[model samples]
Target: MSSGSNSARRVASLLRPSIIDSGVCRSCQETIGRRSYATATPAATESTTTPPVVTPAYTINAGVVLSRPPQITRELEPFEKAFFFYQKRLNERLALPFTKYFYFKRGTPADEDWKKKIQERRTAARDIGKYNAYDSDAWNDELLLGAEQSEPANQVEALVQDAESTANATSQDTSKKEDIPRPYPRITEADQKNDQKSLNRLLSRTLYLLVQSKEGNWKFPTSPVETGETLRLAAERTLSESAGVNMNTWMVGYHPVGWHKFNAPRAKKGETAKPDASGSKVFFLKSRIMAGQADLSINTQNLKDFKWLAKEELPQYLNTQYYSNIKNMLADR
Candidate 1:
C-alpha cells in the first residue's frame, strides 16, 4: 500500500468506538482535533412551501364607514308601531278595488319627471313584450290624479291646428260643422289621452325597490356577517351603509327570512379556484325603517337611485324565487 493510505488505515484502527458514537467521524474530528459544528438540514424543496393566508380579526368591506347602532327609546316598541301601520294599510287595501292609492302634485317639475318615468317604463315593456296597464288609453280627469291633462300628441296637435285654421277662414267653402273649432278645449284634450295611455303603460309594472350599484347593477345592499356578530347585526350594518342615513331608525326581525347561496364556476385549464370551493352564503333578515324618512343620501352616494318596493312588485326586477319570498313577506297569502 501507498504510505498515505497505510497511515489512514493505522489511524482508523486506533480510533475509539466511543468517538464514533458521539457523532464525530475520524476525518472531521480526530484529524482536526475537535468535532465540526453540524446540524440536520432540511431539503431545498422544504423551504419553498406556500404560506397560509391570514384573515383579519374583524372583517368589513372597503370604503365602508361603520355607523352607530340604533337606540331604543322609552317610546313605542318598533314592532308595535310597524304592526299598527301594517294593519291600517291592510284594512285600506281590503276595503277598495284598488289596493293602493297614489296622490300626485300638479303643475310641478315633478310632473314632468313622472311623465318621463312613465314613458321610460312603457318603452321597456314594449321591448320585453309585456302589456301596459289596464285602461291605458284612458284620458278622463278623474284617472289623472287631478292634473287633468298631458301634452297633446303631434297628431292631436295637428288636428287642433287644423280646426283653428278652419275657424279662422270664412265658412263659405267648408260647411262641415264638426270640423269647426268653437270654444273647444285645445291640445290638452289630446295630450291627456296620450298621457293616460302612457300612465297605463307605466302602471302595468309595480314599483320595485332597487339600488343602483357602483357597477350600475341594481341590487339590494348586502354584506358579510362579521365575527361575533349575529345575522341581524350584519344585516343592520348593510342597511345602514346602503339606505339608512340615520342608523338609529332601522329595525330587523330576529330570524333569517331568506338566504342566497353563491358558488363560483369551475376553474378553466391552467387556472385555480378560490380557496373555498363553496363561495358564500347570504342570509336575509326581515327589516324595516322605524321612524326616519326614506333617505337616498347614505348608501346611495355612489349610486343613482334607490326605492322602497313592495314584495309583489319585485317580480319586475328580481329573480322569480326571490320575488316569491319577498311577496310572502309582504302579503296575506
Candidate 2:
C-alpha cells in the first residue's frame, strides 16, 4: 500500500469502536458493550469520588423527667365553673322525680325522717335559681338565724343567707349516713409555707423533680450512658443513684421523650482538653412517681438541694435556655 493510504487507514481505526470477535456469543458481546462506559475521564472520576463526612463525637447522657401527677382536679376557671353549674342544673331538670316511698317503706323511721326533711326543705323539684328558704329554720343558733323582729334589708344579704342555709342543710343530708367522709382540703401546711421539697404541696398541679448540683446548677437527674446501656435503663439508674432509692417510680415508656444538646465546656487554664470532647447530648425519659419521696441525703451525685415544683415554677430555678428547650415535655397544669 502507498504511505499516505496506510496513514489514512490507521486514523480510521483509531476513531471507530472495537468490534466483537465473530466467534464470541451474543451475551459476551453485550457484556463488552457495557464495559465501554467504564472508560474514565479526569472530570468523571473526580465527580464520582467523595470524601467521607465526619460527625463530631458527643458524650451521651440520659435524664429523667421524674414527676408527680396531680392528686386532685385543677381549679376551674370562671367560665368552666359556669359551664359545670349549667350542666348540673340541666341534668337535674332532665332526671325523673325521686320516689322516696319506693326506697324507704311507709311508716318506718327512715320514711318518717325523709318526710320531715322534705317538709323542712320545702324545695320544689323545678326550683332552679331560688335557694331553700325554709331550710334555715332548722338551725338552733340565734345569731345565724338573726333576731325574730329583724330581717335582711338588702336583697344580696337575703340571698346570701338563703344560700348559706341551703348549703348547710344539703351538706348534712348529702347521704343517708350522718358520718359521710369529707375530703381533706386541697391546700396543705406545706403549700401555705411554700415548701418546695414536700410532695403534699401543689396537689392540683403536676410536680417535677429538679436537683441543684455542687456547682449551684439546677437540672433534672442525669447520668452518663454506660456502654451497652439503653437511654431508658440509663435514666432509671440515674434517678435511683442521684435522687436516692426511697422514691417509688416507673418509667413511662422505653423510648426517649426528648433531647437536649450543648457544646462541651471549654478547657480551663492549665488544663489539657480531651481529644474526643466535642459536645454533650442528653436524652430524657419520662417517669411518674406513685408514692414515696426523693431523699437526696444518701445520693452519691453531690447534690446540695432538691425541689418538687410545678411546671410554671421551673423557669425560676432552671436556665432560660434549658427551660425553653424542655418546656414542651412538661404538663402545663
Candidate achieving the largest TM-score: 2
Q: Assess candidate 1 and give its lDDT.
A: 0.46
Error of model 1, residue 251, in angstroms: 2.2
Q: How do the residues 214-272 of candidate 1 rate in per-residue lDDT, one tens digit apiece?
A: 66665556677767877667766677667666534434456665555545458889998
Q: Write the per-residue lDDT of candidate 2 for residues 1-333, one digit (tens) a residue.
A: 899999988885565434555766777767766764435655644467687765567889999999999888876554554455455445654464655567899899998897676556434343323432223432221222232212212323444444555666767566553333334666899999999999999999999999999999999999899999888889989999899998789999998888888787789999998766688888899999988989888998999999999998999999988988899999898
Q: Supply every candidate's count of residue pairs whose N, Cα or C atoms clash at under 3 angstroms.
A: 3, 0
Report the lDDT of model 1 for residue 199.
Answer: 15
lDDT by candidate, in order shown: 0.46, 0.75
